[model samples]
Target: MFRATTATIHTLCMLALAGCQPSSDGRDHGQMQLDACVAEACTTLNLDGYGMRDYNAVAGLAHVTSLMVSYTDFADLSELAAMSQLRELHMGMTEVTDLDGLAAFPNLEVLHAQYLEPQSFAPVAGLARLRELAVGSAGLDDLSFVAQMPALHRLLVVNSVQGLDLSPLAGHPGLRALDLRASDGMDLRPLLTLPNLQEVALSRIGEDIDPTQAQVVAQLRARGVSVDLDAIVVPVC
Candidate 1:
């Protein structure tokens, strides 16, 4: 749990320094509302834009388990290094360029990141406890990292870089559900090798697609895995 005393002190100091005053405009704007974040025992932090960049503000919340950050300019997650108990993270439409800070949370289970700049997900592959992963990026091309996540069960990938290869997902021991979208053709044969697959949804973002993709879908259906080609599956946290 968070040290209430520490958070109180920090909050008061921040408030005093900023000289926070009620705006005559009566509109909710500016940086993240710091006082509201600590009201819930500081266990869950939701930062929704407004130029919130000071990650150190929540570093004292040692027990925080779920965090959501969006529409910010911070490129890396280095400031969140102290949140070791974090389990779920929803970071979308942010300036985050790399996932190096993920190493701090060995217990993380669910991760959702989208609309990011080009970057390698090399660090995410090391999360041994991760079960569900949702990522959308035009810059993410190499997916070999998925092979290392033996515990992964559900995966959602959207807007992949053109010509993305999904060979890394073959023969996954525990994967049960998968949702993917691509603007270009990608080999879909890997889905056939997933022994535990139960459901799959594929969305074509462009007209270009492999001719054999229909056959692959049929094969998965024959094997009792539900496949939906026309449906668009969006992952959320």
Candidate 2:
């Protein structure tokens, strides 16, 4: 009776061990199903209504290039380091205050980060391949760091900064368009020295200038730089 009872216990242990064995067949089947689901979703991604909660769902996908996360409540994008192929990133109107996690995307070209602070652009200087950058309505007072970026082409700084001196953008041959409007105390004389400047928007210059502001405007026009005057209208009726 004792031997029979031992045999029954041993048989049960063997069955348990068999159940614990890793099955390649089951793993392969699960992997195939996961791959198919990912393939279907990538081709038909509806990125409009998705919020920060859905960010984890797409973080594993390595094939995505363009991404727009505007109006989301995401304050940090540390998860984006996994996406090596990301080219364009839009984080406009979000609660993000820091740009520390952006160094991983070496292939990033265009970046639109409007309505942020001055420290937000600290990580942008590391992107060597970045071409176009549009940052507006942010409390940016200094652009001296932008001189390090060799590949920058178009830059728009409008309606936020109190005083901006663009002397750092002197020797950049790749710069084409520069828009500086409604910046309270900005001096336009430094930008006229740019060798490759083509299009410039210097609207609302009279707000910060004194009585001799016309002479300064005349100097900018003489240097072959197009200046658009932004005049204020007073209602008399």
Candidate 3:
């Protein structure tokens, strides 16, 4: 288990001074954005949309409540353990493996990974306060870790739906949003019984959902649960 030290303060300063450098917002900004990301004192760090080839700024961030690093190639998260105040962390395509760095943020409430095929949540199982989790890929066959998340309310499993088995979610009542990009035909009936699942968004279906499966999703929506039946790709098979 990692603990705070003087180094934590230095890292926090780095994050605060992130804007002292200068850079553009991705879509238009590149390393130039992060390079200019040095500030004096700030809490929320919005590094989203930057093609992050380096993350030296993490060391100087402390007391941060929300940090968005989504849509970048950031791999190293060793500096995260120091941001004890961190609550929301968004990462994408960074090709990360270990999550020990995240264990330090006991206050983490939301964790978003653009693609989960390359990451693991096993290390963060101790995050008792996690309320929302989003993964861009559903490549993993074992998501039992989800059940371990007692405070989880929103979950987004995007990209591939290969080998998905959501049976473990049978009794999950706290989840309010369930977003899936594709599911060969994973029976969503189990979700209907969830007491608090308020919204279900099935976006970007790779193959057409069979009629029976489509009806199952429809039923969940008809039962007063919100559903984003976005362009069902192809008609029901």
Clashes of 1: 0
By TM-score, who's the top model here? 1
| Runs off by more than 4 Å, candidate 1 | 1-33, 50-53, 205-210, 233-237
In the order shown, the candidates' Cα RMSDs to the true structure are: 11.0, 22.8, 11.4
What value does the lDDT take at residue 175 in candidate 1? 91
Tens digits of lDDT, candidate 3, 1-237: 011123254464455335322245553464444334444445666666554545655656564577777655556677565677888887754556667677777898988765545656676667889988766455566568878886888876655556377777878867877876555557677786678888777653245667876787788878798766542321110
TM-score, per-candidate, Cα-based: 0.79, 0.68, 0.75
Worst ten-residue run, lDDT, model 3?
A: 1-10
**C-alpha positional error of residue 1 in candidate 1 after TM-score superposition, expressed in Å:** 31
**Candidate models: Cα lDDT each:** 0.71, 0.60, 0.63
TM-score of 1: 0.79
Output the better candidate (1/2) by lDDT. Answer: 1
Question: So what's the TM-score on candidate 3?
Answer: 0.75
How many clashes show up per model?
0, 0, 25
